[model samples]
Target: MPDLLGRKFTANEPNRVYVGDMYLPACDRGGKNMYLATVIDAYSRKLAGYALADHMRVSLVIDALAHAHGVRGSLDGAIFHSDRGSVYTSQAFRNYCSSLGVRQPMGAVGTSADNALAESFNAL
Candidate 1:
């Protein structure tokens, strides 16, 4: 609920901070849409987890975070930053973060600066 990271997208150690975002990869067929949610460890500068689905629901991000948990074992005392998207702000997501002992900070609306890292990752 707060700007915890304050645009400082760096972590001194792994699992301290994670940035995530969703993007739609180009599809040649164009019959169906696919969305990808990714989680990157800021300290390691590596992809910690990701999920691909035909929808951009809260589950997409949840799955990605879950994958991070699975890979990292525990997400307690970690900070997860993202844009003010509906899925990120949904109650389901908030509850998921709480269950994992993670703090979720969302950037201001209409500005990508606060979520630059994840936005850039999605662009790439």
Candidate 2:
């Protein structure tokens, strides 16, 4: 759908809302670089889930979401907000979210402000 997170930085409950993003580590080891995918709860500002891997593939994001699902027990009707990255826009990730009864909301292209919370989290 649209930018569900929009500019509002609050959620009514914990597991019902989350923001996700992928970032590159600062220290590159010269070899294959690693990426970090993080999902944070909007209500409590708690890290719902995260995954680090050698690739920024769609599976990385799926794994992070799965981790969040595992920790939260359920993500039914949860809104997963993220930027318009290919990994987030892939059909596989979309199907995965649908299977878990999660709603995938994407931010505008090239607009970091659309996903400010997740971006801010990545900064830290």
Report the number of the highest-lDDT candidate.
Answer: 1
- Tens digit of per-residue lDDT, candidate 2, span 1-124: 6987776868887788899999997856668788999999999988999999989899999999999999988899889999999999999999999999999998899999999989998998
In candidate 2, where is summed lDDT lowest over 10 consecutive residues? 25-34
lDDT of 1: 0.92
Cα deviation of 101 in candidate 2 (Å)?
Answer: 0.4
Candidate 2 residue pairs in clash (backbone atoms < 3 Å)? none
Q: Which residue runs of candidate 2 sit more than 4 Å off their true CA positions?
A: 28-30
Write candidate 1's Cα lDDT for 6-101 as tens digits.
889999899989999999988523577899999999998789999998898999999999999999989999999999899999999999999999
Stretches of candidate 1 above 4 Å error?
Answer: 28-30
Q: Which pairs of residues collide in model 1?
A: none
Each model's lDDT: 0.92, 0.91
